[model samples]
Target: MKSNVGSVDRIIRILVGVVLIALAVTNVIGWWGWLGLIPLITGLVGFCPLYPMLGLSTCPLKKRQ
Candidate 1:
């Protein structure tokens, strides 16, 4: 899939994901923190389904081969 997440977006997602996971593991945010997996997965994969549904894309233009 073409990348839909930009560098800044990916960074934010990773940061948020890490925080959520930490909070969950430490029992500070409860099981709800598990939901962070959504951002984590999307960030790692660089493809966000919701972005397309919302007609949003932060990725840079790609050069044609």
Candidate 2:
């Protein structure tokens, strides 16, 4: 993938994912917290399949070498 997720976006996703997983594991929240996996995976992969379908992109244009 061509890194569809920007740096800031990736950081946010990672933070949110960590929080959700912590909440779930600690039982501070419901199993719904597992939904955080979506962002976690997408952030790690650097590609969001839904981006094109929704016409959204946070990534900056790459500089040509």
* Model 1 Cα lDDT, one tens digit per residue, 1-65: 87999999998998898889889999998999988888888988999999988999999988999
- Colliding residue pairs in candidate 2: none
Q: Which ranges of candidate 1 are over 4 A from the true structure? A: 63-65
Residue pairs with colliding backbones in model 1 are none
Report the lDDT of model 1 for residue 5: 99
Please report the candidate that would top TM-score against the real structure: 1
Q: Can you write out model 2's per-residue Cα lDDT over 1-65, one digit (the tens) per residue?
A: 66688889988888898889889999889898998898888878888899988988899887999
The residue-level lDDT of candidate 2 at 58 comes to 93
Q: Which ranges of candidate 2 are over 4 A from the true structure?
A: 63-65
